[model samples]
Target chain A: MKGAVERVLRPEEIPQACDDLMKAGARLQMTYAWFPEPGQSVEVAYLAVTAPHEPFLFLRCSLPADSPHLQSLAPQIPLLGWYEREIQELCGVIFDGHPEPRPLVLHEGAHPSMPPLDPRYQPDEMMPFTSEPWDRPPVEGDDVQTLPFGPVRADVLESAQIFFYYIGEAILHCHPRLFFKHRGMEKRFEGTSPSLGVVLAERISGVDSIAHSLAYCQAIEAACGCEIPERARYLRTVLAELERLYNHLHYFGHLCHTTTLKVGEAQGKLLAEQSKQINGMLTGNRFLRGILKPGGLRRDLDLSTLPEMLNRLQPEITTYLRSMEETNSHLDRLITTGHLPLQTAYDQGATGPVKRASGIGRDLRGDHPYAAYDRLTMNIPVRTEGDAHARVQIRMEEIHESLSLIARAAKDIPEGPVSSEISYVSGGEGLGWCEGARGSTYYCVHLDDAGLLARVKIKSPSFSNWRVFPLTVHDTNMMDYAINEASFGLTMAGCDR
Target chain B: MPVWTLYGIRRGIATTSWPKKDGAVAQPEVLGLPRYHADRCRDNCRACADVCLPGALSFESCQTGERLALDYGKCIGCQLCTEACPNDALTKSNDWAFGVRNRDDLIWAEALKSPPAEEVTRKIQKYFGRSLHIRHVDAGSCNGCESELQALNNPYYNLHRLGIFFTPSPRFADLLLVTGPVTYAMQGPLRETYNAMPEPRWVMAMGTCAVSGGASGGGYSCGHGVEEFLPVDIYVPGCPPNPAAMIHALLLLLNRASQHVQGGQVAH
Candidate 1:
């Protein structure tokens, strides 16, 4: 409700209502869940003011599914284009005047009228829609040239499909279509208990396992009305910061690797390894799984291990940072490689490093204090360059900040039971948001009478960041694609889930 | 100009003569899977089995107490079961070389080889003599293995000094390190990778998913396990197998290869 305004409207008034909203300088952010019964269907649309510091508005409309149609919000809010397309694809609701009605989340062969997120939707029973085989469109022009890079690239990392079009030296167009390793995680979550749901969330992204799990746990905890112990809160914050550190370090190493700076890559790897070691010391698993339960933390941080953890990490971090400085080529290669204008970052609603690089000071850890974050001092790093170098510097600065926060948390370690006892409550909806390594991860949980998870909607940070990639890669050569991608560190698993 | 080389030399012999010298596990955190004590088993309790992601633990209950059977063949070294056990019955061990020739030989907990310290030390010393070259082929992994694999070269793990190195060309490789369940998309690439390797080259399926298609195998496009597509000499299981276990598997392969090269019957 911070920047959100409220409004109520009838089903027939949606088209003109949206028009009025547009005239009032408001744009559709996204449409939330649609409640559909035997004959009637009601949908909620959220609209926000386009300008900074403007309020958001929510409009509700009830219509019949047989002839369900709404006025398109694309002309007013360009960002809503993808969201609207997704709604039409999944909900089987038509946007009468929309530009494109193609599916966003589903594959080419998915059923056109199949309700994707609806409780009745069954993967095995229903026939999936099939389309003509998709082949990359060829470039047509004397100057224009098409350059296809991967499904297989030199990175020796993750797999992705990318095609870049160049008009001489400058890039004309770039399209990145993923789903090389889509595991159908969302479908798998059906019929799964909340306890098992935590595992799925953690596995969504290996690097951001703790963050995703924490978000899912928060949702369940909120629904159950579970008040986590203060010690558990501190431990959660510590783990989240540790996850952030390692992820940033890994990204830094990747950036160096792409830039062909061997020494810098080596130093970055050392830092990342140290962070992983620290994670393992804190929790038995290096990825920090099972440390978080629905109510609170699963295990208490052993005070005896603190000294050893600090002794192993602190000196190595300092030495690695110094060694990183010795390699000037790493910084040089990343300086102006992939630049996104400040406006583009804001327009795309970019979060984490992408936003920070563009000098947009938005960090959920500082803005919305959750857990032990309220007790700690938060520093938001910003750079106007908005290039690969700026992103790396922002990460490096954050890594230093995180180390300090970890030190502080460890020093002021509280004494208490790590978890609080809680019972189940039925018929409640709870929203939980956490600042994951990538950005803000939001989880919405709806519980049944038995306190089991009836429905869970997870919006990972990658969902928000993926849009910015195409925009940033605009006009840049194909070779610089890896550098830009490495800087962003987008996780396909998290997005697909 | 020579400063880098001088620094490299200054950090001399960072590589451990692992199997020979009982190479110190730089990070004890990632040693291996937790060992369960059967004496502490409770009546009708399958907590460990229930929590296990890899389906490694199986519980059979009588009137008095339940007998839990752990199959290392299925275990991913997740250690979730260890944490879930209410009693202090489960604990992790430092035994890294759990590789074997046969499917039954790979079962760690059942066989539970706890060799004497001196013997382990001698084995380590003997294994550290020859460098084992590895060729890594990612059969549609989530990049978790790639990240962890990259970490092996860091100063802390420094796998290069352990007589373990990742070869660029498959022809020179003694081991074909495969990560992830063989996906339909990567099937051709993976098969090509195996064919490119030398005749005596062993295949180490690294991770539970790679060994048995982890979690992603139940769906379409996933090709179950590497063994279905190609012969697997060893299976180092984990969600993404820890770098230590990966190194251990490589060393074990080198030992087997060395025996094979010496005109001796390589033990399965």
Candidate 2:
């Protein structure tokens, strides 16, 4: 991959080019279909980031609107199965010769006339209109007992149905039915001002709000060639890392909760609650919604509050993590269970702690250097075990790095305005990539002459990581399933959106 | 392993004193509801209404002049309207909690209106007077609401202290506290969960999404709020209502407490 490259290729060259790029140590970052107008040829773009921090290489190919078909790239990168099914269901882009063509985001309730995201969908058409039943994928074995987990269960954060095919206790196969929370996110971005669209993007996955909106704004800024001020960059860095802090805290709290360690769970939850309160003080919303806009930040940060918030965070976090490390009950439950092989992780494009625990040292913050991450220096922690314990270790390590990053960025914060002037002529496509708390988040924004989005495509970190679940969860003990699931810290809403 | 217990003892008590004391200060900076002043709103200026993303703020021109209407159910509390208002008509105030017993009490015209002058539902009060079991369903959410819901079980809120426990099985639930706008795929499961609950049950719509569909209300993949499919007895509005606010709503379900925030105004 070379510096900032974009080119259109014939349909036949897509798979071949993707295969070559994969061989060259490039990982598929995002894939989507773009329809500029109804009845026009469907344009598809495949974005890949090469190893050792190479520039992004964007490869595009147009399929005729009549056929709307392309050769599948799953044969090259097996994890693209989710991406392919998503585009097939939303954009009506048929993946010819693909292995699994079952519906991904769409269900029986969607109007049969057109895919929800199809350019031809009428504005007046109701979203989907029924309590649609999902077809549970067959998980075959002789003594397999089908266990449907949930679209709604216990105290799980979001809704998703996972079918575990089990013979007594050991699992034979796992088939997940997601999109129970799909809300027509991408299609709704049409015709809205980019400033308001920032709000929409933030809601793409509420936990990853800052990362998503920042990426969306970065896309618009990159398109307009607007350079954010140094102060803004540093502030963005602080906010991003702060977000990473809260999410990691939340994930750890959850991990302890899964172990049924009551005291440890409270300790973790206390830390998580403090993070939310801190976020509320810093950004006015607990989840940091509406703080990021297209040109830059929605407003300036109150510099005086930073030292106090950071001071409050450091000691509490350190104390809890220190106690957690020394606690055997907590550590024992996490060790040597829910192991995912490094090869499976890499093959599936697993990200965040999942990828780091498996020892694949690829972090978009360090690699692509979005926001002001390029200004900060830190080590990307990695663990070879790829077990539940390894995931915890990675998150704990990242929390320390994030705290250091925020402190350094805040102290050395440049003296300038927070937001910059941006001029939008509209009629270009730009890609925004950021390392969210969970993992990498990708946004592709295409704007028309009217400054409204022609199309908005997202490949959330959850979308890529969910594919790895079936591959890893298979053959794991039935009783250990909940703990293993907690290990990944998967956000069903992100995947469903 | 035994040392862990010593460590826990060293950590000591961290429980918040909300409902017991004035310790319910969960998110101090979050202004619970957006306070609206119809008079301060400049005549014929629809600036606040125009920029409202979720259509929570709206104005209609009439013979008298222009009338501004606020449906708290539709408000995600992003505060864009507060920023958009040229005058001090809409100001950012700390009024985050807006959990009410009757759904209509959420709507605002000009003044803060109280719930019906009539008496309470004696039957529900009698059934869940002391304790409440809630079964939460995420019809279709961004997980912002769910994150807050999870926090309710944390040390700060410790919801069980308030006699509300989140039961996994709907069979034991007295109230169905549902979040998210009902999505296409989730409709069947949400209804099934509600139906599974025995008689003398109530449904509380938490957050703007479940109350008025939030941003994804009429989109291609979502049904507008839970009210369309099920009977919602309470409506709590926020992008994701904070944990303290969630407790207020749950308490209001059994007539335990009166409405703290009415219309867009929060009580002192």
Q: Pick the candidate with the highest DockQ.
A: 2
Q: For every candidate, what share of the true interface contacts is present? A: 0.22, 0.71
Task: Report, for all candidates in order, the number of backbone clashes.
Answer: 12, 4
Which window of 10 residues has the lowest lDDT sum in candidate 2 chain A? A123-132
Best by lDDT: 2
DockQ-derived CAPRI band for the predicted complex in model 2: medium
Candidate 1 backbone clash number: 12
Error of 1 at B115 (Å): 16
Write down the lDDT that model 1 would get: 0.67
Alpha-carbon local distance difference test for all models: 0.67, 0.81
Maximum-TM-score candidate: 2
Model 2 agreement with the true structure over A1-497: per-residue lDDT tens digits: 12247878999988889988988878877788878766878888888887656778899888888888888878668878778888898788888888776777787556646766766786436754565566666556577788889978777458888888888888888888888888888888887887788878878788888888888888888776778888888888888887888898888888888888777777788888888888888888888887777767768887677767778778878878887888787778789888888998988879888999998888888888877888888899999999989999999999999888988888888887888887765686777878888888878888888877888888788887888867777887787788888888889888888
Which tens-of-lDDT digit does each residue in A1-497 have in candidate 1?
11235566776787687777677654444555443352366354554434433333556666676777777766655556666766675566777778655545555555534565555655334333344444444566777877765444443456555777888677887876555555555544554567666766777677788878888888778777788999998889888988998988877767767877665566667778767877776676778875787888767877567656766676756665555556666566678878878877765657787788888777767765677988998788899999887887788788788888887887777999999886656655565667888987766666666666656666677766787778888777767777788888887666654
TM-score chain B for all models: 0.73, 0.94
